[model samples]
Target: MQLLSVNLAAPHAADYTDSAGRVTGIDKRPVPHPVLVTAPGPKGTGGSGLAGDTIGDPRHHGGDDQAVYAFAREDLDAWAAELGRELPNGVFGENLTTSGFDVNSALVGERWRVGDAEDGPLLEVSCGRIPCRTFAGWLGERGWIRRFTQRAAPGAYLRVVEPGEVRAGDRVTVVSRPEHEVTVAFWFRAVTTEPELLGRMLAAGDALPEESRERALRRGA
Candidate 1:
């Protein structure tokens, strides 16, 4: 797989409704040059991991577990066809727009070596992107959040295992795959709709975000 584009956002007034009632930085655009990717420290403390990108809401946005968001070009194309509209890369506020990758099927803890050589950035799949009201408002789609959740291919959030520069056309190699079967798609479904599968998520262990793991453990209790 390869990186189709590396996108970043600038802080701008969002015309969408959210808990903040005014959102910003959800509109990301692709950059032609390489962008530095690093850990954002932790949730609510750091902004986006991308050097120039802005995170409007830290309460739910930037964090170690969600340092980078990736979406597949193939999935965007599918949405375009379904909506009868052109869906471009980064339109979904993803940091990386990837091609030839099945991001939804990626398992939590799966490690990817992004870029050219062995020294390239290492990223670990952390969890699935959860659709929210802000996302619905941005898309202006009726029942968008519910629809996106029901579709259960909500893309993937990644943690930076090794900081490095990434750019459009960089090679993306799956360096390691977790032995567990709890893929991002499955985790999304379990958390969003299937409570029965919450216990199943525990199999992923620490690969899942601590918040998610706790939620699953609580529900399963």
Candidate 2:
């Protein structure tokens, strides 16, 4: 797999999002150069892990678990065909737009080493991107949340397991895969539409976001 481009947010105003001096950072654009990747401390305190991307709303976005959002270029192409519109690399607010990667099919806790350097950034598949109203408003699509959820290709959120510089065209190597069957898509379904599947989500272990893990735990209990 390859990193097609590294994208950063282009701040823009939106009514469906937080208005307390916070404009939506849902509009992301691809960066031409390499960018440093790091963990953004925690969920609410810090924003995007990329050097200069904006988060707009920290209360519900960012942090280590949701640090770097990635979407497959193929998925974008499929959406473009379905919507009959052009969707750019970062149109979905994904930090990394990947080609030849089945992001949704990635198992939780799977690790990827990116770039040519042996010390290149290492990222772990943490969870699936959860659609919010800000996302729906940004897309301007009717029933986008329902549409996206129904498609079940929510992309993937990654945690920076090893901090390093990453650039477009970087080779993405799957360094490790957990011995679990919980892919990102399955996890999304389990949490959002299939409560019965929540019992199976525990197989993913702590790789899931704390809230999701806890929710699954409570359900299984």
lDDT by residue (tens digit), candidate 2, 1-221? 99999999889877889735759888999999899999898988989989999999988999999989999999999999999999999999999999998999999999999996565789999999989999998899999999999999999999998899888999999989999889999999998888899989999887888999899989978
What is the lDDT of every predicted structure here?
0.89, 0.92
TM-score top scorer: 2
Candidate 1, lDDT over the whole model: 0.89
Model 1 earns a TM-score of: 0.96
Model 1 lDDT per residue over 1-221, tens place: 99999999855666674535475777889999889889998898987888999888888888899999999999999999999898888999999999998999999999999986555689999999998776887888888988898899999999998999999999999989989889999999988889789998999998999998999989877
Q: List the residue pairs that clash in candidate 2.
A: none
Give TM per candidate: 0.96, 0.97
Q: Which pairs, if any, clash in model 1? A: none
**Model 1: worst 10 consecutive residues (lDDT sum):** 14-23
